[model samples]
Target: MKKRNKFFTKKNGFICAFLAPGILLFLVIYAYPLVNIFATSFCRWNYKNFQAPEFLGWGHLFDNYIKMFTLDANFKMALINTVKWVVLTMVIQIPFTLLVALVLAKKPRGWKFTRNMFIIPNIISTAAIGLIFLNIYNPSRGIITEICNKINPGSNVSVLADGNYAFWGVTFAFILFGGSSCLLLLTQIFSIDPGIYEAAKVDGASAWQIDRKIILPLMRPMIGTVSIMAANYGLLLYNEIALITGGGPDNATFSLSYYIYRTALGSTKLNFARGNTAGVIQFILGILLVGCINKAFRTDQGD
Candidate 1:
């Protein structure tokens, strides 16, 4: 017992030394900002009073939150768009990546080449990808316009100019490029023991049965991990809208992140308090999303 206690004490000192930097970094970087935003959400800190945040009285503590839901049309629209994007990530991106991972796991002819090609988009910088899609939706010199003209004879189909099309244009720009997530899923799938597959084959298990019963079940934790990442990306999407639509065609493409920027920093009439309030809501939503995905996947039960 004395030796064991001494061993643990020595190990604990090294563990504390290893953890100190990360804990300090988190406090300075993430925790401080989160606390600051949550506190300032109940204050009035805008261009008019930029020196310091003036706290709203106790009775009016929720004034900023109430104003967001009641009086702010832009915030409502941004929230709705953000939620839609999250749903799309779950419905489209997760499934599409899983499908690609499953297909590639079979090691088909040229599977390595195919996997490399699929991952190219994800490896490219997001800003560059945004610019590429922006030009693709251009009216005069874009492939889409040329294709439309070819099909319909003199039709000029400008995608990003219209609100509805702009939304979809932004969606398609980032939605299908789930290469990184697919790679993670593939790694998880490949890590399964080969002996299990051989035994299943001997037991008359078809490839489909193996994939459905064994692969899918084992990949749940990884799916949840990638889902959280994809969902967070969708929720905090800003660069695509900034480069493509700029929330244009009558403020139709406004997302929460974009809304926060415009409200707090981008616009002439900066409302820092309101933006912080939105940030608080976004923070809460992210926590809830992660919790829900963790529950759905039962990631805690993993081997």
Candidate 2:
């Protein structure tokens, strides 16, 4: 008994030794930053007071948040656009990726080649993708402008120069390119037991029936996962906007991430506390989104 206890003690000591570096890194890198951001959201910190944050009195603790909702037109627009993008991800990106994944799972002729081609966009950096779309939306030499002119003689279609057109241009730049999410769904689909498919076939299940009844139900958790990923991507969108529209013809495409950047560092009128408050809101929204998706998919319920 004593020997067993001594062995366990040594084993635990080794485990702690192995874990110590990671724990320390997490504290310094992630936890500390998170705590700092949350705490500083209630303080006054900006270019004027670069030394340290001054705490807003308890009565005015929520001044930044109140100003964001009540006075900051940019913040309101950014929040609205962010929510719309998140909704679009769920409505369009998720379904499109799932459809592509389902089609590829059947292993059609040249399906492997098709899958590789589809994933190519995902492999490319977002910066490169944004640049590519920027050229595509250019007024004079862009393919879109050329196509419009072909359809209607003398027509000049400038996507990035118009507010509504620019918002959608940013959306299309990144929305349908869900190759990574498709890959995750495909992996989940393939992991399903082969015997189940065989049995469904033997039971005279049509392909559509099998897909509707079996595949989709089993793919729910993975759908939830990919949904979270895509939604988060939408919520935190920045690169495409910066490259394609630069938040617009009239600030019509400002995402929360871009708003945070402009507020905190990019703009001359830096408001560190307000930016941090926005960060806190973004963090909370992310947590809520994950919870809602998990609950919708019943992921916590063991299969």
All-Cα superposition RMSD per candidate: 3.8, 3.0
Top candidate by lDDT = 1
Deviation in Å, model 2, residue 250 alpha carbon: 1.6
Which residue pairs in candidate 1 have backbone atoms (N, alpha carbon, C) closer than 3 angstroms, thus clashing? none
Tens-digit lDDT track for model 2 on 57-176?
899999889988899988998999999999999999999999999999999998888888889999989999999999999987689999999899787989988888888999999999
lDDT of 1 by residue, 1-303 (tens): 897778778679999999999999999999999999999999999999999999999999999999999999999989998999999999999999999999999999998898889899988888999899889999987788899999998878889888888888889999999988998899998898888788898999999998988889888999999999999999899999998888876788899999999999899999999999999999899989989988998776336
TM-score of each: 0.89, 0.92
Query: After aligning candidate 1 to the native by TM-score, how far in Å is the CA of 193 from where it should be?
Result: 1.9
- Give the CA lDDT, 0 to 100, for residue 81 in model 1: 89
Candidate 1 shows a clash count of 0
In order, the Cα lDDT scores of the candidates are 0.91, 0.90
Show the lowest summed lDDT stretch of 10 residues, model 1.
294-303
Worst 10 residues of 2 by lDDT: 294-303
- Those runs of model 2 whose alpha carbons end farther than 4 Å from true positions after fitting are 1-13, 199-204, 301-303
